[model samples]
Target: PGPFAVNTATFVGYNLGGFLGAAMATLGVVLPSFLIILIIARFVYNFLEYRTIRAGFEGVKAVVVGLIFAVVLNLLEKNIFGGTLAFKNADFVALGIMLFVLVLKLVFKKKLSAIAIIVISGILGLIFYGMFPL
Candidate 1:
């Protein structure tokens, strides 16, 4: 075959081996995660309802958040803002873009889907990069 084509919208139009290849890959990747999630769910039911476990989880969540915040702050301070804004322009421009997004999210105050954001960002990146090659 010069070109392999399959109707993705129709389930019955595809081959079994191709379908099983997808299913096998999915099973290989997800089985361990599914088992882990099942175990975590069981643990949540058993432990999370209690005061001690609840507090411990809350503290753990806080620590994780703090770690992420610190990483973000470090990135912004070092990479985005840089040492001297008067000398550098690209870092300042990136920092401005980050601030713009943060302001947009804050002003909108609506739950935005990560998928939609990612898709839009990727499309915008492609358009900008294609239109202005520098």
Candidate 2:
């Protein structure tokens, strides 16, 4: 009526503390970033009304841009070209083409929304893979 399952009590209870450990692990990883964002956003909101603060924001924006560029470059190096190399299939090439088009779209400030892009890609994938008959 409700549910059915096989028993794995030994496996499950053997790591009962694992769930609490995950919470501690997540807080450790995220606490610094959260505190930094809170401090930065608070400072910006507090000071943005002044002319000097506005001038300082422009410098902050340039630093933010450099940080964003470095992050993007690191992501590209790790995901697209690094890690494990596999060129036997066309998935990676397709991903590269999709990424290039998306970057161009963003740079030009094109009027396409993320949902539209995702839906179109999903439909293309379904067409190529064939829908399940049910």
Candidate 3:
């Protein structure tokens, strides 16, 4: 989506020169990648049959999961723990909301929709933070 949208916009911007210019701009951006993929697509498929290549891909997947978990921890630290892991600095209201949602998810299974969770969170946010300002 990102490449398609940007490439299309670039083509349109070529109209700053003319329609031909736009067409050239779009093709210039898209052609190289299309050609490269076309050339390498078969080799890539064959390479995937190798054990070492498959293991490398699995390692990449693990790294991606680790990176995602690190991001979640950083956000949790900054938002709920005030950028540090001190127990006293933790926002209990945010923690309570997180726990409540976790419970709902575990206990209810597929009973709750995303909208319902969001609405419940907002109401809880208002009730906890609105009524009692910390």
Candidate 4:
């Protein structure tokens, strides 16, 4: 529960109580973690010189990468593959859009802004799902 929790709370609060609800929900979710991280940051640099602390941080870095990979796989399974890896069940249009964005990233590299990619993807989505429905 980090950014996702904060975002979820914000949206739910907005639905329930407008701007004030969103503000409260975001603060409620973030304040505790913010304080804890603030406290940790103050002492963490001092402890960084110790080998055990450095090694623990390194392990944490690896675990975070693994967790991100797992989440990506889960999203691909549910969205592009329609809950399975079988080709027959795959959503080819969604896969096409993903590949298109990847190709744009590869070709454009740093030239393309995230907003441009988002706009392009949104147009593709509208064309495929809304206008054509195929």
Candidate 5:
């Protein structure tokens, strides 16, 4: 519980095969994308010059942005608001941490790194919920 971590391919590989496994897993994860990019690099410049392709890429970008916004809203409703359908409860601490980090980022113009925000939020949670027992 000292540091929060994501269980990525390297983590899984290390869990299964130690250092070598982690290296292999990292290579396996990256190699395909590397080779594909290498193969596509020749055509990508010319492809982007086409008006239809450019338009398609713009459409894709818009859809991706919309999907990201939708996901964030859904998570906020379910986790922070405690069920959008029922509206039965709300997690004030979770909401507070979210708003605090959001306001800090906005006020500072994203000068804060993600790690700093996470550590600060974790400490705030411990102080409010663990140590002081709010």
Candidate 6:
């Protein structure tokens, strides 16, 4: 109901039918996934009992983790390392903040919560970038 991804469907629906269209579009997008999950829920417990299925799921989990790691690496390369954007000017401030946060996290070994990291990052951004006259 609240995912940002749903905004695409809602936008299309609004363009087509206004509020009613948006509602319908949202329902159209959500209902199938909801129904699919519901249908799968009945068999999930029994399905998990199979060793092959469990192994397949484990493989899927590994793939998902790898994909997530790849995305993080891609973001770091593009944004922090200034891959393409370096042609214009690399945002050294952002790079510094990223390195600082990465080092802090590595040093602390995630003793910091996500909220704490976000707050610290925001403050660092303010100190480094926001406070400066542009």
Q: Number of the top candidate by lDDT?
A: 4
Per-residue alpha-carbon lDDT of candidate 4 for residues 28-112, written as tens digits (9 for 90 to 100): 8999988998999999999999999999999998998699669978876886667554334347655665757774775477676
Poorest stretch of ten by lDDT in candidate 3: 84-93
Q: Write one digit per residue (lDDT tens) for candidate 3, span 1-134.
A: 26776577576767575877777777777788789989998788899999999999899989986996699688767866675543453477566657576747844886776567768767776876678655
Clashing pairs in 6: none
Please give the distance, in angstroms, between residue 95's alpha carbon in candidate 3 and its true position after superposition: 11
lDDT of residue 109 for candidate 3: 88
Residue 52 alpha-carbon offset, candidate 2, angstroms: 2.2
Instruction: Give the Å shift of residue 77 in candidate 4.
Output: 1.9
Q: Please, what is the whole-model Cα lDDT of each candidate in the order they appear?
A: 0.61, 0.62, 0.72, 0.78, 0.72, 0.77
Cα lDDT for residue 33, model 2? Answer: 72
* Alpha carbon deviation, residue 133, candidate 4 (Å): 12
- List ranges where model 6 is wrong by over 4 Å: 1-21, 83-134
Alpha-carbon lDDT of model 4: 0.78
Model 5 worst lDDT run, 10 consecutive residues: 1-10
Kindly report which residue stretches of model 3 are placed more than 4 angstroms away from their true locations once superposed.
1-12, 83-134
What TM-score do all the candidates reach, one by one?
0.49, 0.38, 0.47, 0.44, 0.46, 0.51
**TM-score of candidate 4 relative to the true fold:** 0.44
List clashing residue pairs in candidate 1. Answer: none
C-alpha root-mean-square deviation, each candidate:
9.1, 10.3, 8.3, 6.9, 7.6, 5.7
Q: What value does the lDDT take at residue 132 in candidate 4?
A: 72
Candidate 5: Cα lDDT at 59: 100
Cα lDDT tens digits, model 5, 1-134, are 11122238778989999999988977787778778988899888889989999999999989986996799788768866664443233465555667677657754896776468768767877876678653
lDDT of 2 by residue, 11-111 (tens): 34336646665555455555777799889998877788899989987898899879977996887677667876543457755755675576557645866
Model 6 RMSD in angstroms:
5.7
State model 5's lDDT: 0.72
Off by over 4 Å in 4: 1-33, 83-134
